[model samples]
Target: MRTATPSRAMRLAAVASQAYRRVFAASRLAPLLSRPNPVHRTGYDLDVVVRRIAHEAEDVVSLTLAPTDGYPLPAWLPGAHLDVFLPSGRQRQYSLCGNPNDRSVYRIAVRRMADGDGGSREIHDGLSEGDLLRVRGPRNAFSLVGTADAYLFVAGGIGITPILPMVRACHERGAPWRLVYLGRSRTSMPFLAELERHDGAVDIRPDDEYGPPDLAAILSHAPRGAAVCLCGPPPLMAPAQRIMRSVNPSGSLHAERFSPPTVAGGQPFAIHLRRSDITVEVGAAESALAAIRRALPDVTYSCRQGFCGTCRVRVLDGEVEHRDRLLTDTQRRDSMLVCVSRAAAGPLVLDL
Candidate 1:
């Protein structure tokens, strides 16, 4: 079963919600409207129930979710994710690990981080099949584009989730593709055996890729127009980024920031919304998106890492200092993900 994209009425509902929020800002209704509960407008929201669970690793659990009637599991293009609203009132997003082309059941592989704040543990112990959840979206920020070109996918640990689907997409189309997987061990890595069956070139660096399967050698074999996308731990990503940077421009490389870069130490900045046309100052302690969202609660966004394109806004004037992984050359030319990016020099005026 596949769910349809948001209807025209849904967008209208969002507009209505926005208007209601502004009009009721002085009344008690403002707080009610700003609640992070649910925005029924975009059918991107759904109700789901766990159908089955598999322990892929010590901490990872692969869950199969069933969609409610009229809200069937969406036909997600491979490399998409379903944003789940946890009971904790925070929305947690997970990549669709099942066959992206297969619409029968939506599957997601979740690794429980030792440092995770109970979300992982909930999937392990608290959640079970038949437990209904307010699930929203079969969203894909890491979408597959330019399939005609050669491809190189670099996955580190959980980063494999999005790439798995992309590989399948490329293979079915007979596009040339390779993989550079970095993990701590074969047992701990999810979908290890599945990748081996791909029959294409695969470089698995369990601890360090220091041996014959060095990333340098693997990258040397890349064909022209070969796009590279890396997802994994920060340590693996940094080195991978350096290698990709040496060969390809940022446009040729696609990445989803699993974690925010800790690069801090910039003076306070300001951003002016060209659409909303509101200029807000951002302190060093605050992110551009956090400052924008707090100042304008009507903005609905998901990932704050700029990995997800939900927080994207167009730039009308001034230069932007981009540190996000979601935008393309076209997107970068006009739009910026406020979640992770900040001003390079002067205030950036955006078209929200």
Candidate 2:
């Protein structure tokens, strides 16, 4: 006979008991853990000076960064992003929008969110040209594949940064590609004049003029074996995902989000901080990073989506259900990005 699964209350109770033991263990080992833990600086390796800052749109600014050493920076693909370290020690990720062929400098666009977590605000108000900023990898999770028969690019609001480079690449290669750029208005959208040079078909739909976008009608026109790339907010992405899965299941869909991606199928778990000697209970609906921040407010993190590898911590105990694509097999053996990854079973002991 199969064993019955534990109910939600039972599972929570078990987790609480485990948390108690974890707390006791942490306190017992407090003296031994007093030694300084080595800092994990995976993404930040290069220093780049801000060469220029141009207002791309009403609230968007594009920053061009050049190396201090006067060397060509590391080459990046179309959809790669950088982990930018601000003067305030806060980290934020931005997509590279410049021409990849030009190795002298890297460019990224930022849209100021008045109610955001202060990163964009600091960037808009505090940053200036010639300011030195440390940055990390131009890593790619949404790369343009050459093998696709055609490409359907959907960019919403300020999501045009990554798609801009991909469109340029396709145009240069004489490949078939179409872009549907959407925004609140022409004034708020960036890079319209730059996109005008491309003779390819581009549909610019502003909500003020076009009302709400009929995402189904737009995506239904995707050609067979088309690679559909979407970068937008949840309102655009959610429906687009449902429509694509139903209408264009044969085609592949790759997406990037300005906000953290929704965490699905997560179960409640506990994170035992080895150094802090505290236990953070992770809710099924929230990420472990969110829970830890409630306990330790000053923890450093860049992309909460697990691509930047900034929130990675050593897993001292418990099996981890690794979720991020950024970490290698060897890295997964010992550490996990708490922003996305979670405990495989029981409670986790983290060297935070």
Candidate 3:
């Protein structure tokens, strides 16, 4: 006596009705919608002065920031990142590598991407000590959960920034933890000196010396009930995830990715904005959000990598090929993040 599951069309219609009702109810309840909702706001923008800037490695610089107004900054936990608004008008997210107990200043490290969108370049060239900059969030998308088991941490290149604090926390708590830090070379790896303090618990594998890490062997040898945390390039993280899934079925492996997963042979599609009365062609090389921005320049977006939900839009019609990791299954059925999602079928309609 099992009930039949609703079809995709039926599900979408039901969701649309619910969304319409919610919107209508909100319109009638003026008070509820009138006041500024801080939750919907992007983040609290704070002005901070750069206290110090030092080179941690080749093309890697660490910046220490303190409040310009002499007030205590918001507290952050391990694996937190800050959204820094650069002088070049580009907003980028950087992991907080400094000690969490220290309230006097916050520190973050940056690696200059030679072919990036100029954010890291600005941090390297346009910034200096005593310079004021705007920042938002000490948000943690990859937080360490409370557990009694030992921990295994894997970091690649600049990915070590987030894991550094986690290692420190484990050390302070007398918890069992091991770190496998990988980089292209020893001279290019940041926080080597700091990690060397815990030599017994750290394995620094420079690619030039050790080739690639033996991930299969590492995961196979992981302690039972150990929580594995990984942060690195997609190429490395993708394969690591597969190995982790095979060896650890409990899904204790956690990973944080800064870049969007690469799509191969993406099909070109069209998006119709119902409210804006516009239809934009999304080329295979361009994203839906980019196409929309060409017609409507004021659209809000952050973290084009698709981790942030700042560019979410309601879907009125068409199947979505969601590419983001942020949305839950329920949310994905009705809405899509325009930054990374695309239409699975021909033309998709949006409630923009």
Candidate 4:
């Protein structure tokens, strides 16, 4: 979620409302604060064979993969996703929907969007059952921290993939959980019938058949310590989050973005490569990933947002103004995500 900034009007109103107060903690107020970004992570490659394929929705395809060498399947927690190295070296993230406990095969759901740039559409239009693709990761950006007093799973369109396993986890752990699955229509929704098995625990809101789904009402049911996880377009998350805050509180609601944040050019920073001893300039026109690859063509990266952590390198010196939301506060102080983060000042050194 993007950070919120206080407007001048709010400032003026606060000044007028608290005009009689001797002192006030306005800076401590949320209106002045910006929401922090979620941490990024890395995953390893596990090249697998596409054992089977099934169409779940008009734009969605489900794939069953097997280890090419009969290696043990990557152990994944519920609500995990994997990044696939597609044809032409393009990387895309997909949510895992198969049973985590049953480790024989890994299942994933991919939706071809109308605005999708070739990659997803290719999965729908060209990928076959026998085709093999380089697959990496079974990672969880939206991991269940095992803390929530109750769980509320809200999903939209292809976002349903991640939530499915969460619902299953809730059931397995005997945790109090509810799912409000939203889709454009019945047939267009993948795994609808299967989810209906949890009839009382799940609510299916198809846009074609139902009145507008009320996020506020649904959020009201979220008790304290309730962890609300959402995966979908930016719009779907905003309203749901609004209700989450109005009813529950901030930080109680969590979200996962398959895409990275927009690249707003910050002040130029110098990058010093200790291993290579090369310094490169990165600005709005270039990223550390791009600059490093330019000097060192062999550098590999998948998700540039630093979530995949593929391009992570050691920080030998200098203050790195971390912009990517993927690094832990501790890790940020020690290392750097070269993909999105840059040095806060000039002459930054990296142990590349």
Write down the TM-score for model 3: 0.77
Arrange candidates by TM-score, descending.
2, 3, 4, 1
**TM of each candidate vs. truth:** 0.67, 0.84, 0.77, 0.70
Better-scoring candidate (lDDT), 2 or 3: 2
Look at candidate 3 and give me any clashing residue pairs.
none
1-352 per-residue lDDT for model 4 (tens digits): 6644678668786566444221222233321121111242233356678889998887788999887655346567777777888776767778889887665688998888788556788787777887888876666667775887788888888888888888998998899888988888888889987787798999889888886666787777776778888887656765765677777783388777555544566666678789997888877655777778778876766667667666778788898878665667887877877778877776688888
Tens-digit lDDT track of model 1 for 41-90:
12446577788888786477899888654223445666667777766555
RMSD of each: 11.4, 16.1, 13.0, 18.4
Candidate 2 Cα lDDT to native: 0.84
**lDDT values for all models:** 0.70, 0.84, 0.82, 0.74
| Window of ten residues with lowest summed lDDT in model 3 | 33-42
The lowest-lDDT stretch of 10 consecutive residues in candidate 1 is: 33-42
